[model samples]
Target chain A: MRNRQKTEKDTPLGAEAAQRRHRAVLVILAAALILCLLLSFTLGRYPVPLRELLGILAAKLGLPVEPFWTRQMELAVWNIRLPRVLLSVLVGASLAAAGAGFQGVFQNPMASPDVLGASAGAGFGAALALLLDLSNSLVTLLAFGMSLLTVALVFLIGRYVKGDRLVGLVLSGIIIGSLCQSATSFIKLVADPTNKLPQITYWLMGSLSGASWRDVRLAVLPMLLGLALLLLSRWQINVLTMGDDEARSLGVNAPRVRARIILCSTLLTASAVSVSGMIGWVGLVIPHMMRRIAGSDYRYLMGASVLGGGIFLLAVDNLSRTVSESGIPIGILTAFIGAPFFIWLITGRVDHYDG
Target chain B: MTVEVEHLAFAYDEKPVLTDVSFTAREGQFLSILGPNGAGKSTLFRCILGLQTKYTGSVRIGGTDTKTLSPREMAGLVAYIPQSSRPTFNYSVFDIVLMGASRKLSPFRAPSREDNERCRWALEKVGISHLAQRCFHRLSGGEQQLVMIARALMQDAPVLMMDEPTANLDYGNQLLVMRQAKALTKEGYTVIQTTHAPEQSYLFSDRILALSGGRIIQDGPPAEVLTGETVETLYGISVRVVSLENDKMRVCMPINII
Candidate 1:
């Protein structure tokens, strides 16, 4: 409210300053993400020295490099560490971008990628695949397919319901999500007690531990496609947040644009979950943080969120590995960071952002 | 441009909300829609804006029926300003105004330099260029309403349709918004607005449209249609239409006011 009345510097210079701040934050976030990716390469259990990590990266860029570490170290950096780091980046960027888009279109700050039941549906898919003893690739494919299908169902139902489009989409998502969750639980109930149940439970908790070059390759295209579509619609997403009637009056085909956004976000989220398991908090928390930093314009919010989310997950994944001998799951660590921040967010600042 | 409505009617769930509604306004004219709740003023606005397609009637703008025109084409002809309220996001006032030019913007591009200048021009027209940096949701109700008017102006359309332009405003702000709307008419734009206050209609409008029971009961100049009997019948309250000596100014004062 204090910022509301102080149009004192309402000059063009002040507006320019605000634009400068947004650009600055975006630049800083992008730089910080690159730094974190390099830093994550050096922080694991058998830590590769920073010099060795740099030399390996420099070698990859086609520059000649004298080896600072042995063949095993090179293998660790290129084979094991790099793929997992890249996976974290893809999953993190995809979720945050989708989450920010979802929040905008739904006009709800609390909205996340799971608002349309993609996560629960994908979780059920993965659990069913595991219970049936399917191959890893088959499990991922099923999960991705199911997530898209779930959202499609919710979207179709929301379309038929005659009410506020945002509310109907969200309501149908919740209902379908609960149903999928129950189906997943039923699979748990009937699974073999020892090997299969633990795998399902651990998978549901989320990790990048099993990440490989294959997963990274498979996830990158869909994530990038979804991200690109979202970035293109950032300006339209701004109009969407104003509500449907206003959007139409401005000559936007509100339903078409809203569906496009929902579709892109769903595909992005489903691809991420198929590779990384049901990672929470990255989607919900990172968008909130980006909005607070850059305000709610989707133009800056989308790019800032991608970088911010990637940096956050890479850092969290590092902490997950270094904090314990066996390494905690990435999902648990995200909660450790996200829950307290959300409490801080909601205690005083929720209502104003709604306005 | 000319706006012509013929035999416009609408219903919801077998209940008629507007029937046989018709009106026409041309360049440099100001029209006010006066009615109580459920009188279908908003529905009529929606039909004209091409938002409500299920209705049966022709809303012709410049000899082209709205039903025949695309939504984009309709936007080029009429700009709509909804009743002002706090928005969900804290978009800068400039960006909010820029959105009004979406009809001219491509889906994959930012606002062009000319669009930005137009937005600034609109801000100046409403005398709020100083608050262009402020969050739209943070402004006062009157300021928000003015920004909405500026947004409508930025659309650069020939006709402006506003829903309750002075709603939820104090007296001074009401006059401020009403005066700006009136000024738009002198610039050769057709301005149509709805208001519950008959006095505001009498004060700001060159013509009045009085609606009751889902129909236009009276439509004419303010001096003819906004009489004490029509005002009383529309709002279900008896009021005296008092005229002042200065330029024949009128005020609708309730008879019960001692």
Candidate 2:
């Protein structure tokens, strides 16, 4: 018995090895995200060299490196390229992490940030702002507020409806989301087709163009808070997937944990959609890909989704700006790219989407 | 540890389920609850587990009222092992077992190194250490049941409450689970299981409680309680209580089949 105890204390072989593999996968994902970050800085309209980019990064961090880059390069890198790239990364990470959280909380593989209608509601908020010719910051603020309001409405309606609580919440989201969609349609119908119509339509299509540092500042706090809370409560998500009765038996307060997850995910989705204007498939597709890569232990899956999302959106955002003289809307590009990639992932792999 | 339930009556919106049920189980005793489908066995278990608080009566564990205990305290008193079912996500067996330690942790805290050690020890005790890295959904039904047993062990509770632990297993697997439960009783842990199988209780349980229509009809040693008449009354199926190997073992066989 003493010998067996010593052996067990050394960490059993199979599970330790598997954990090491999962850790390696997370490390690889982080490395890839860093690489994409560096690449995004250099691949914009006014190309910056790798050396100049490094110098500017060092200078920005208050290192003693001298700037060899021109003033035009500095302005492009710091002002235009920096905020857009950072916002894309932040928005991408938030959406994907929120998607993963929603999927776990709902115990459904197809669940995403939009599953609760945050995106649809934010779209309506942004449309109304555009039609009213509100300031850009007001558009973002209103979108964030209205997005949260929509989910609150869903939860309120869900409380009164009968049957399964999860089904009720999803049904309410669907109903309210369509309601917001038609409202946006009415806004479009009344606006001038020459100017206001095009503006509202472009905002709904989702873009990162003209993203300023102020926009990044506006979104950073809520996005970071949501991500931090989700990461802290990561293991609870795994417990919840066993179903509420089992979770309760395991000593977790299922309803409380579920509420925290939904609130955090809503914060993430609302903030991301408000700034980026309804970027869709990053939340849906990146998490599924991360599940294939990291396996489904939420401890690792949550971090993987965050990093995987940043890499995917950073890469896609680069493509959006540089692929043509006129930048394509990110929402259009995400669906255009995400759909076929998702199909290939599902078909090429012998995996099922139970979670 | 001792469990005492007194005058436990429960109703769902005016429809009575379990009525005036009372029982006591001490440590190291293997208690089997035999009842027909919809006999309120599940509702009784739910009340004891503190999942249903609407029941009228007192449930005490280790002489403390269960009503006053927090969920974490309740988990520390008794661990629940549900019948094997596939989860939505295919979590690794180690991760699933580690979750049993959540009661000892705060909501935001992950399992510590000590918790992981306990989890490994529990898996080894359950003789499924080899499956620690395997995905839960990929395991066989018997193996899944053992995994759940390991999880309960990781809970480090004094009593283990199982909901039909061997319900869907084959004959060999059923015996395997029963032997494990019996062994737990020998280790001085209270083992309470609910099942429809009378012969299983006859072979393994130290005491049997026969429940019919939300009431306890009989409670005693298996030999005193699992008679031919009691079996017929519980299940409404006539059966012959057959003795094997000089009454060393008992088996129930149904009679009057068309």
Candidate 3:
């Protein structure tokens, strides 16, 4: 008889290999994140060596102090670079988590939080705030609110179309994004070109320039809430990647899960946008890097994306400061680095999208 | 556990797909839904699985109304393998099968050792344990189908609903999948499968439900329901149904038609 053998006691290596790879990737990402944070703290116009940076941080924490404490170095490291680095890490983690969640929910690697008009909506809200000269807190609130509202609008429109949710959602996002961009331009056109317009344009280009302890405090609630929600929803995201029908069969209330993920992702995107303006590429590239490194399991993928994104943006922000006499927009630097890397990744792994 | 569907009515927009369809599958019975294309068999499966909420019907599992159960609870009772689904990403065969246990595991929890064992067991049951490490999309169509069935088995649900499980397989693989599905029924799974092959329904199914234009036109043992007249009426083609020694029937198209 042919080996119609149905039973085999042999355990497969796929699961083991996947777990090992995931663990290794997590370790690497954690190490990279720590290294980037340290580098960001150390390297600047006036480069503080690693030892001095550590010494200053330890001294600030009331640890036994190292003898070298210059006021200029103290001011540069603590007052200038620290807040920017912290903000970059927070914003990057937020965008990356949002990207991972969006990709999982939509079952499309191409889907990002910004694809649903969240970023543009936030930009428009920020632009309007600039034109009206709203308070900082109010501007942040308006940006966050409008961002979520835009996603909700896209979701509603997608449902109304009664087709593939990913396609519908993306199409509606494009329409809404254009509308938001036009509104932003109109606001820019109407504002004082010398003052408000330049400020709005610079903000829209995205930076860690104005990042402060206050902005960080304002960002904490939404960022933490969004991350917690994404982490909690990660496993459901596994079933969700199977597409709507299969996910439903696996006992996931598909619409409810999709809505929750979208809400969390939008909140993450909006909060990051509100804090750092419209930094791009971290949301788009970080998740793909995570997926390539850590398999498709969202539990590990989301974690890696969070940490990896944090490190990536922090490094980019550091380069933004050090590369030029006049600091460059962090978003522009991210695009310049991210776009070529993405093209190379895609070209090498064209079969990644086959299934 | 038995599954009962009554007065099922479903529509996409204004056009109806299933209307007043009623059927029942006793515990551990292999029920094959045979129909022509667009005959609403898939719609029926979806309704029973609670995937088609727009349908007006009562679907009961183990005598409990499906509406009373949460999605996870429903999934624990019934597992579904779609006709053909494309994963958007490259997931391992084991990972795909482990998804079947999602209902039993918490959102934050990793698949437990028990879940992993079940996944391995399911893969073995489908005779694809060796393929567990392979990327799902990298597998042949037949292998992918088996992996999906393994996933459904990992659900460990009492009722298994498979839509065209053998549709894309070659002749040998077709028989192989059907044999495995039939074995599932003997293991106490109430299997409901939709297929184009009357031969498969004849050889493996305990009972056959023949659908036509959104209604059950014939329902009985395979030998009784898979008649030449019913086949002709449903498919607009001629077929031959012959009884064998074990009270099993063989269905085949006439030679001239081929």
- Point to the candidate with the largest DockQ: 3
TM-score of model number 1: 0.96
Which of the predicted structures, 2 or 3, would earn the higher lDDT when compared with the native?
Answer: 2
| Local accuracy of candidate 2 as per-residue lDDT tens digits, B21-137 | 999999999999999999999999998888888989999999999999878889999889998757888687889999999888898888877887888899989888866766688
Per-residue alpha-carbon lDDT of candidate 2 for residues A1-355, written as tens digits (9 for 90 to 100): 4454344446556566666778899999999988888888778579888899989878999999877889888889999999999999999999999999999999998999998889999999999999999999999999999999999999899888898888999999999999999999999999999999999999998899878999899999999999999999989999998888788888898888999999999999999999989898999999899989888889889999999999999899999988987899888999999999999887875432222
Candidate 1: segments with Cα more than 4 A from true spot = A1-10, A348-355, B256-258
Ranking by lDDT: 2, 1, 3
**Against the true structure, what is model 2's DockQ?**
0.48
| lDDT by residue for model 1 (A22-140), tens | 98999999889988887887787878878888898899889988777889988888899999999998899999999998998888888999999999999999999999999999899
CAPRI tier for the interface of model 1: medium
| Chain B fold agreement for model 2, TM-score | 0.97
TM-score of chain A of 2: 0.95
From the highest DockQ down, the ranking of the candidates is 3, 1, 2
Worst 10 residues of 2 chain B by lDDT: B130-139
lDDT tens digits by residue: candidate 3, A165-233: 778888899999999999999999999998999989998999887788788888888899999988888
In order, what lDDT does every prediction score? 0.87, 0.89, 0.85
Model 2's number of clashes is: 0
Question: DockQ numbers for every candidate?
Answer: 0.53, 0.48, 0.54
C-alpha RMSD (angstroms) for model 2: 3.5
